[model samples]
Target chain A: MRATTLHGLKDIRFTEVADPVIEQPTDAIVKVIASCICGSDLWNYRGDNDITPGMTMGHESLGVVEEVGSSVSSFRKGDTVIVPFCHCDNTCPNCTFGAQSACVHLGFTVSGQGEYARVTQADGTLYRIDADPAPELLPSLLSLSDVMATGWHAAVAAGVRPGGTAVVVGDGAVGLCGVIAASMMGAEKVVAMSRYADRQKLATAFGATHVVETRGEEGEAEVLELTDGVGADAVLECVGTDQAMRTAFAVARPGSTVGIVGVPHGVQLPVHRMFRKNVGLAGGMAPVRRYLDDLLPLVLDGRINPGLVFDKTLPLAAVAEGYQAMDERTAIKVFLQP
Target chain B: MRATTLHGLKDIRFTEVADPVIEQPTDAIVKVIASCICGSDLWNYRGDNDITPGMTMGHESLGVVEEVGSSVSSFRKGDTVIVPFCHCDNTCPNCTFGAQSACVHLGFTVSGQGEYARVTQADGTLYRIDADPAPELLPSLLSLSDVMATGWHAAVAAGVRPGGTAVVVGDGAVGLCGVIAASMMGAEKVVAMSRYADRQKLATAFGATHVVETRGEEGEAEVLELTDGVGADAVLECVGTDQAMRTAFAVARPGSTVGIVGVPHGVQLPVHRMFRKNVGLAGGMAPVRRYLDDLLPLVLDGRINPGLVFDKTLPLAAVAEGYQAMDERTAIKVFLQP
Candidate 1:
């Protein structure tokens, strides 16, 4: 199978790799139907996070199960399923509390950015789709495997509710999807803080009532202005940067919460400021598993189109171009067909 | 008027100062009935926080309303009241949401250890006790002015639900009172983390199911072990230290909250750990004004005895000794009758 591999910083290649097989009794092999590069993928691609030669290129994916392990009761061959980026037992303390991202038995399953992948704990990690849909729906369904669930996780972790005001910091695909998630969660207002025109449009399309083309205090003031100086009721920190996290804190109203879903790079929270405002900060790696079942139906029902953030699509061989477009801010996220 | 003044490091003096009068249309002059030293006051007395000379030391007190400005509608001369340490308009956006401590028009209202003190937003800040409480009840009424309310705020902000497991971090008067508040709020198990014998006894009396003489990670481990490796449902942080904050995080169950009410000196949070655990951190300077209405009735009804934390008392002119006792750890708090 040909797969995208991260060999080094700014280094990626389409290389022939051996097909994946279930090594564990609870594992299942998936024929990757759709996969995409994640912003987190850029973390390793940019040399900030360590990556070995021939490492998996992506985590967001949906595909057809080609084989199931002997102990896998919930999945079988030819089943269409969504895979949470992280594997979990779904019965552990963390998983039961909906913090599957911190599941004690969590680890990365088979790399998604390949023609074939293997998933562990198939009964707990795999979510079968409602019904087999058309190929055109693949991108959107595949999104539920990661990006959409991630965005929903951000909104849920932030405690987004009806009549609540949500400020989404960062305008990448996950951030834009967060706007959709917040809107779906019944937020009265969704303010997407984005500087780029294209991403801003996507954010607006996802139901952002307000778009702030500013950053830092100015962005916070814009949210406050929209909220009549009280600040947003919920803040979703979708970009994992010190400044994005700071902006999330600045714009959240006192007694409200800030849910951060971005894969953190180096975030030393300004605890003094948080404590002073009585702000609740909660978020980490997206508990994608917790959100898949709930968000997938919304996508299938046409209540939301999270795939709008996928502004570009290409064949698997053109994956490098997709990465470049996202790197240069020309695309929110790209859908790749293998 | 006799007042406590910070003269230098480890030095406070009872000095003669001019009696205060109503300085604003919303102010009320009160003849000080009693004032006491707070744990935070020790920070200034110990020279940890900069305090200018003759700044009028006390922020908590019970007093007689000597005079009322034209705008003081609820307060009048001859009224006996407890002044909240924080003055609030009780009408700001933040205050409307029950965060009166962060009121937009918030102003400091400590009148020092003096004979006469003035309170701004008097109509809002002064919680009038029944006409004239008996001399025996004065001490308990004075406790409602700050520490008691501070503890209540910690418990309330931490979201101690009925049947929840609660841990009070810090053995100070506020922490002990937090045990009382959590129990009052229907917490099933209240664990008091204290090393001091007297404070632990007070915690036991206040409704702590378990009192552990533990600190830092050891304290967290004990709590986790006690709760079956899941941790407490709520934690009240009454000590503002990095270690205390860490303990709060470590002992909190997933989806639980940590209410921090301590006046932080140099507290840095472990952002990464907090995010992964899905812990909620909410706290601020206690909105004493908000809790006074709910707590005063409890104190007056003999449901709680918060003033038990005051181990010693002194005369008005002997406030310097009160500060010294608290500063030197000889007393948790010292009440000074003015």
Candidate 2:
């Protein structure tokens, strides 16, 4: 099997790797149909995260089941499915509560970027579609593995209710998806923070009612002003920088929530300020598997087009170019057809 | 008028001061029927907080309306009322949304420790009962001013639902009130963290199903064990210490909330941990005025006895002794008759 591996900063290569096989009774081997580079993937690509040389790189994928272990009775070969970023037993206390990301017997895979990936806890982590989805639905189905679910989690945790105002704090792929997620969740007004014209267009298309190109305090002021000076009822922090976190808190109403989904780096919360205004601070590693049962239908039926985030697609051999495009902001997301 | 003033660390003096008079058209002067030494007050008394010399001390109060300005239309002279610690012009966006403590035209009164207090924003901050109640009801009515309201805010913010598990993280007056609040809110099991015999007794009396006399990690372990290792669904942080805050987060299940009403002093959140598990961090200054309409009935109907927190009583002249008693932990709360 061919797989993408990181040799060093900005150095990604497609190389021959042993095909994955079911090693446990709970495991299943997925023949990758489609995969994508995530913004989180850039953390290691830019040398920001500790990247071990030759480590396989991807966590999101849509695929077909090649084989299942003896104990895996829910899925069979040729079945199309969405594989979540994290694998969980699903019967654990955390998984039972719909927080599969924090599952006790957690299994993670970087093999997602490869042609054949072994999926542990197949019955729990993989969601089978009633039938093989159309090729055009692949991007949206793949997104259900991570980004879309994460974006939806941000809106859900922020309590974006019907007729409420919602604010998205980033313009990345996930941020654009957040605009769509908030809209789907019945937020009357979705505000997107974006300075880039291209991303702003996508944000608007994804259902952003307003767009503010300003930054820092000015941006916060604009969001607050747009919400009648009371701030948005729910603010989604899609960018985890300290400034984004601060703006999320600053632009939320007293009883509202700031749901942060981006993996935080050096984000120290303004605890006193959040406390004083009673703003709820929530969201993290989203339980993508838990949300698939609900969000996949929207994707399958074309009620939502989250796949619009994939601005570029390439063959498995062009993996480096895909990463380069993402790093240089040439694409919101880059799909790799395996 | 005589008022309790902080002279220095551990030095409280009952000194003569100018009588409070209406300074705003929205103001009302109240002859204080009762005031109590709060656990928060001890911060200044113990030198943990900056002790401004001659600063009038006390925030909680229940009293009779002595005078009202022309604009004060809610009450008549001699009407008994509960004055929330934070005086807010309830029409502000924050107050209208049920966060009176963060009101735009916020007024804080420390004059409750005095013989008479000029309540600002009288129509918004004072809740008038139907009529003067029996002397036996004074203690409970007086508690509605702060501690009881604060405790109730903690439970409400934490989303304490019927048949859920609740954990209270402090053994002070407000913490004890939290146990009662959690029980009143329909939590099936209430766990109280206490190291003292007297406080433990009060906690059980207040409907604590279990009591754990440990601190920090050990205490969190006890709570997790009590809840079958799933942790509590709602954890109330009544103590502002960093340890208490950490334990509150540690003992809460995923998708749960840690409601902290403690006046935080140098508290830094473990943002990464909290984010990973999706534990919501919420609550701050209780909007007591907003809760008065709901909780007052509970007190009036003898459904709750939050006033049992006040174990000692003293005249205005013995204000210094009241502070001393609280400082020495000789009394959970000290009631002062002005």
Candidate 3:
């Protein structure tokens, strides 16, 4: 099978690799129908994160179960399902607490950008779809594997209350999705911070009631002004940079929380300021599996169109182009057809 | 009037000062009957925090209202009241949100160790008891002004739940009170991290179901072992040092929050580790004014005895000795009477 593999910096390639097989009794072979690039992937593609010579990439996907190990009971061959970015044993202590991202037997769903991928902990990691949906719903369904659920996690962690205000710190795919989550969760006002014209349009479409085309202190001031100078009741920090984190705290109201979904790079939290304002920090890696049940019905009913984040789609063989498009800011997200 | 004042590092003295009066239209002068040395005060006493020479000391006190300014409405002269350490005009946005500590018109109740203390925001800061209580209840009532409320804030912020496990790091007056808070909030297992035998006994008396005498890795291991290797559902970080913060996070279960009330000094939060585990950090300076209503009844009914934290009592003239006793850990806390 040809899969997306990273050799080094700025070098993503569609190369031949051995086909995925059942490696454990809890593993199942998935024939991936669709997958996409995550903002987190850019870290390794830009040399920010060290890369191995031939590590398989992609942790988001929706597919048909090609085969299942004998021990797998909840899913079988021909079943369509969404694979969470992280696999977990649902019965683990962390998973029982709905923090599946920190599951004791956690494993990443790598190799998803391929013809076939082996998913471990199949019963606990895969969310089965009752019927194979139309092609148009594929992208939205694919988002449940990671991005959309991650955005929802941010809103939930931030405690976005109905009739309150929410501020989203980043304008990336996850940030746009966060706008949707906050609005869907009933935040009366949703503020999106963005400088790009294209991303701003998407943010507005995804339920951003206000858009601040500024950064740093100026952006914080704009958000404060929007909230009658009281600051946002909830804040979603989708960018992992220090400046982004700083802005999130600066604009958070007293007793409010800043839910951070971004993977931190050079961020140092303003602990003193957070202490003074009673602003809390929550959220980390999203427990995608835990949110699947709530989000799937919304997606199936067309209540949310998270798939709109995928502004570009390409064949799996053009994986290199996909990475470059995202790296160059030409694409919000690139959906890959396997 | 004679009051406790800080002259320099470790130099506390009872000296003559101007008598406190209603300085603002909203001010109320309270004749302090009972006051106490707080663990936080020792920071200035030990030189960890910069000391302003001749600064009037003390923020915890309960007394009779001696005078009320023209605009003071809720409190009247001769009324017995609990003056929160921080005075807030509870009408501010922050105060309305239940974070009176960050109130727009926030002011610290300094001079609380004096014969009379001028408390600003009288209408919002003073909680009055129906009648003058017996002398025996004075110490417990004084705790409602700070320590007890601060401990309750930690538990509330940590989201202590019924049938859950809670871990409290630090065994100072506030941490000892946190044991009572966790137990009162219905945590089935309340663990107190302490090394001193006296503090351990007090913690047990305050409802600590378990105590870990070790520090660092050994302590974390013991807590993990006690919770069946899962970790506590809620954790109260009562010590502001980095190590205490680290242990609070280390023993917190996934999706649990660590409530921090200690004023941070030389502490750097582990943001990366927090992100990976989904452990949240919340709480700050306790909003004593906000919690007064709920805690006053509990104290009035004799449901809790947080006053036990004050192991030694001294006349206000012996203010110097109170500081030394607390500095040397010779007393858990010292209650001062004028």
Candidate 4:
């Protein structure tokens, strides 16, 4: 089976590997239908995160169950399902509390950009799609595996209220999806912070009522101006950089919360400012499994086209190209066909 | 008039000063009836926070309205009222959003230890006690001005739910009040982390179902053990130190929030752990005015006795002794009568 592996910096390879098999009684083999490169994947490619030779790459995908362990009861062979980036025993205390990402029996959906991938805790990790949808829905369905659900987590964590305003920081796929989530949650105004012309267009299409191309203080001022100088009712921080977090807190209205989905990197939380403004910080590695039930129907009904974030699509064999495209900012996200 | 003044570190003087008079069209002069020494005041006395020589002290007080400006409408002369530590217009965006501490026209209720204190934003800052209550209820009523309300804010921020478990980190006056708050909010189990026997007793009386005398990992383990290794559903961080904040997060269940009322001093937030566990940090300088409506009735009805946190009482002339008792940890809190 061909799978994406990282040897070192900027070295993503579509190399041959043994076909995935059930390693545990709770495991299942998934024949990948569609997968995509994530923003986090660029961290290792850019040497920001340490890489091990031949480490499996990718943690997002939707696929058909090729085989299941004898212990698996909820899913069987040939069943189509969405795999959340993180695997969890849904019955665990964390999972029951709607924080599946922190499940006591947590596992990662790595090696997903492959012909076949083994899924641990199969019954608790996979969400079965009831109907076989059109090919056009595949991208949206795949997004529900990670990015879309992550964006939805941000909105929920930020407590985006109906008729309120929301501000999304970052222009990545997750940020774009957050605009959709905020809009779908009934935010009267959705503000997207992006500098790129292409990303701005996609942001607007995804329900961004306002777009601020500026960054730093200027961007914060623009957002404040848009909200009658009071700041947004909710803020979605999609980029985990210090600057992005700063802007998130700065533009969050007093008594509002900032939903943070971005994996923090070299970020110093402005605890003092957050305290003074009565702004709260919530959201973490999103409990994607928890959101699947609510988000799947939205995608299936075409109420939200989160798949639009896939500005480019490529064959799984061109895995290196996919990583490079995302790294070079040439693609918002690169969808792959296995 | 004599007022409490901080001459320098450890130098508190009850000295003659100009009588407080209406300063702003929104201001009111209140004759101090009951005031208290707060834990934060010791920060200045202990040289932890910079002390401005000859600076007027005290922010917690309940008194009779002595005078009011032409624009003061809600409060009248001779009316007894609770003066929240912070003064807010209550009509500002932040105040309207229930974050009066961050009100756009925010002001502080300083010189509250004096015979008369000027309160800005009179219509918003003063919560008039509708009926003339007995002297016995004065202490409890005065607590609603700050500590009690601050504790309630922590519970509200932590989202204390009915039938849930709550862990309060810190056994100060505010933390004791938090126990009252958690129990009132219907938490099935209230855990108070304290090393002092006196504080533990007060905490138990205030509704703490459990007390852990250990600190750091040991304390965290005890709390985790109490909750079947799942941690508390809501955690109130009443101590501003890093250690207290760390314990607050450590004992918080995944997907729960840590309500922080302590004014953070050189505390480093564990953002990584918070993200991984889906634990959220909320609450800040409490919007005491926002909580007055709900808490006043509790105090009036004898449903709660937050004022019990004040273990010693002193005449206003002994202001220096009051600060000394709290600074040396000889008293949980000292109630001062002017």
Q: Which candidate is the best by lDDT?
A: 3
Model 2, A1-338: lDDT tens per residue?
A: 88999999899999987888788999999989999999999999999889889988888888899999999999999998889999988889889877788887678767788898889999988988856677888888888999999999999889899998999999998899899999999999999999989899999998999999999999999999999999999999998889999999999999788998999988889988888888878888898888887897798678999999999999988999999999999888998897
Top candidate on DockQ is 4
CAPRI-style quality class for the chain A–B interface of candidate 4:
high
| Docking class of predicted structure 2 | medium
Cα deviation at B331, candidate 1, in Å, is: 1.9
Please identify which of the two predictions, 1 or 3, would achieve the higher TM-score against the true structure.
3
Q: Encode model 1's per-residue lDDT on A78-158: one tens digit a residue.
A: 998888788877888878877787777776654788898878778888889855678777878888888888888889878
Error of 3 at A212 (Å): 1.0
Off by over 4 Å in 3: none
Can you give the TM-score per candidate against the true fold? 0.95, 0.98, 0.99, 0.99
Q: Pull out the clashing pairs in model 4.
A: none
lDDT tens string, model 4, A1-338?
88999998798899998887888999999999999999988888888988788988889999999999989999999899999989998999889999999999899988889888889999999999854668899999999999999999999999999999999999999999999999999999999999999999999999999999999999999999999999989999999999999999999999999999999999889999988988999999999899888888888888999999998999999989988888889999999998
- Chain B TM-scores, listed for every candidate in order, come to 0.97, 0.98, 0.99, 0.98
Q: Report the lDDT of model 1 for residue B107.
A: 68
lDDT tens digits, residues B31-59, model 3? Answer: 99899999998998888888889999999
Q: Calculate each model's fnat, 2 decimals.
A: 0.56, 0.78, 0.75, 0.77
DockQ of 4: 0.87
Task: Quantify all predictions' global Cα lDDT against the true fold.
Answer: 0.84, 0.90, 0.93, 0.93
Instruction: Name the runs in model 4 displaced over 4 angstroms.
Output: A130-132, B130-132
**Model 1: chain B TM-score relative to the native chain B:** 0.97
Poorest lDDT segment (10 consecutive residues) of candidate 4 chain B: B129-138
* Worst window of 10 by summed lDDT in candidate 2 chain A: A129-138
